[model samples]
Target: MSPTTRASRRRRPAAVTIHDVAARAGVSVATVSRVLNRKTPVREETSRQVLEVARSLRYVPNVAARSLSIRRSHTIGIVLPEVHGDFFSEVIRGIDLAARRAGYHILVSGSHSDRNEMLEVLAAMRGRVDGLIVMSPDVALSALHDQLADQLPLVLLNSVAEGHTAITIDNYGGAHAMMRHLGTLGHSRIAFIKGPDRNADASERLRGYRHAMRQIGGRAADLEVPGEFSEESGYAAAGSILARHERPTAIFAANDAMAVGVLSAVAAQGLNVPADMAVVGFDDIPIARYLAPPLTTVKVDIAELGRRSFEAVIDRIDRGLPDQPRHECIPTSLVVRQSCGAATSLRRTKKASGKKKTTRQEEI
Candidate 1:
């Protein structure tokens, strides 16, 4: 309890500071800050050395302090309909890549088909993020515009909201192309596996299918089966299609997930793809190419879509851009594969068999 003993026992904090990191790396405090914030270019070797020193010293940046000083968190918010699927995952991967490159972070939330939920999510992110990218399948454009407009810098993905910066895939065009490809393969009796009723992309795709059916001038089977963009729905829809008095020569599912379901159902029924029923899907998911017969699908660059959406928000945030909304439509293309039956081979087979080309029936 002596005064000298008490003084010797006094503890000192071991917290690592930026100055410690800079001094160890032989760099200025400003250079350390720039390297940590990624706000300006630093020499590659110097940046590496500083990072190494920071790691050795266990220096953690004070994000709260930085945010207070800059009045920005250097973070972005993402509002999605769901998060578990390949589509959402790819989109998120793209967003993460872009955000990391620009020294930003992400806060993601799935609205789960509830408008109020989406609003709540947005409210939670009100001041936390520099920008937001939303994927709303159930919420209408007008509702989104009314609620989210001027609230923050925003980018709408897979849905078109008027007067907001938006990016959307060409669902209609992709569907149309799918139908045309099936028609070329002599699949006059083509069944459509519809997507979720609440999604605009689903409706647009359906419209495209119907439009293409009309143009093909055939007795296109008027069969439209209900689906919720789920594999189970796709399986059930396939059952419904098969139960019909006249089976379809081909089936086009709205998206690849459902298409996978249809493939499973078809296999369960001991039917071979293309031969028993040609199958095609949209969104060319990663699994498409690995399916039993490989899927013929509409290729949408999902990851690229996510990357561009993030970049669009960053452009608005960094460049001090105006609040005027912008719209961009990403294109789609058909990827021919065995499931849909090769058009050239089918024609050649028919020609070799000396079979007359029969006129298509108009069923749509």
Candidate 2:
């Protein structure tokens, strides 16, 4: 309870290991190893006793030794931008579930959205992990190019950097599709809250928006606002757009978080969604469906993205990058809902192009 006691508790010895189990069971180290690895069948009662002793001591097998024996870590290292968003968490959950089924554990690292930290994470994972998975990285692609492709089997998720196995949604197609959907609903003067400038995914999304606006036969200049993929930034940026006396009838945010913020900001000004100022977001995070008048956003198959990315890295690690399968592409689509000038029609969500999902690629 006291400060000294708390500090001492924090400095306690690390968790008990296999040797502790062996010593407690009065057995040789090899016996303990064989028991855990099931290399040979020990007498049932003896195996029970050893397991009981290990349990009592909270003894855990060493991952390193097991990996060395199998020539595989049965573990993968995943580096993420940050843990704050649903997008990252959902992908991680999918990866974790698939990895667990495949008899692997995930060692995760957070780069905290910094370039140096990304490098540090990559360096830190070099030898200790079997494969690597990184998302919308903050590091320069050039720095990761040579080493990432050869040194380790790497998967790039939600970001497209060359020389690594990549699993990403159709960023350009999704954005372009969503914008066209808005135009279909009679929203012409649309504004955008762009995602981060340097991030590859964000850049791809913004490019799609610009390209779509051009397709609508306009210059598309000054159609975007400087905004990060956060609700706070979206809300704050809304103020400037509203104050400029040049309000657009619809707004598109690069991701759902910013879209939610835009909705909140507009509502605060006594405006409405779709009716007054329509909103569309990308990457349909969970909250998108639950909002008042569910958000009409682009649905990216987040789980498949994670699973494919994780599997790609493992495949590249176990068997050198295969030529047959280079990159796994996840599809995205405009989910029409009440928020984007569509009638309060949840049934019409899957289609904005007035077509149904006919291919497995489109569904994914």
Candidate 3:
């Protein structure tokens, strides 16, 4: 317990810092930092030497210190109204992968479909993140316009909320296309399942269906059911649709979850798809192909939505806002599987064959 022995025992290993890495590599702390953060390109030899020194010293850059100096967290945030599972996760993966490629990390939170919760999350995230990306936001568009829109870089996905930059599929076009596919299938008395009323994307899709149905059949009354983007809502809607004495010949669910529910409802009523009643869904979810008849649905490139949303925020963060608010309307197309995307190919093939058959008859 001598004082000298105690002092020696109390001594701690020197914690490695960026300064140490720079000194060992014979470079400036800035150069060492650029190399470690991968912020800027480094000469091959210098990069190798710096990396070697950092590893030798067990060096790790302090992100907070770096952010403090740079005024950037090298991070973004994604707030969601409903981030169910597969769909949101894939979108997030796309955003994360693209962001990392550009040298950034992400912060994520869910809004639980609560307006107050969304407001709280946005308030809490204020001034912390470099940018924010929201999916299916529940905030008032006017509030976003007046108060928070210009505060930071913001991008919105599948949202009714307004943004300086936003990305979403053409739900109206996609829905109209789907309805036209059903029209060609001899489905005059088609049924429609509607998604949440407040959701801008769902509302546009419903409008598309109504308009397209009018084009084909002149009216869409008694041919639509309500849905809520969930299996339970689909099931409930399906039950009511089936209870009708004059049921629809075909049913187009607003989304795949509703289509699956329709499938169950159809089975309960002892009806087979494309035989007794054709069923179609939207979103082209991964499980769509595995269904009994495979759900014919509209496909939105959800990954691209996520990737583009991230890009939108990054662009805004780098450059000031555009003269006018930028609103990007992404394109969506019908996927022609046995359920829906394939409907056109099959009909075309059959028509070509029929034409050939008629030609042979004429020759004979």
lDDT of each: 0.82, 0.76, 0.75
Candidate of highest lDDT: 1
Clashing pairs in 2: none
- Which portions of model 3 show Cα errors greater than 4 Å? 1-15, 23-31, 34-49, 137-139, 143-147, 160-163, 339-364
Off by over 4 Å in 2: 1-61, 146-150, 321-325, 346-364
- Rank by TM-score (best first): 3, 1, 2
Q: For residues 1-364, could you state the per-residue lDDT of candidate 2 as single tens digits?
A: 3222322345556566666677778887788877777888787887888888987877777677777887777778998988646878888888998899888889888888776777788788777788888885456667655456556677777776555567877888888888877777787778888888887788888898998888787557777788888899999877777776767888888888988888899899998776888888888888787886678888887887888888787787777656443676677766776788676533433344444421111111
Indicate the worst ten consecutive residues by lDDT in candidate 2.
355-364
Task: State the local distance difference test value for candidate 1.
Answer: 0.82
For model 3, how does the per-residue alpha-carbon lDDT over 281-348 read when each residue is reduced to its tens digit?
88889998788877777777788888888888888888856644578776666665664323334332
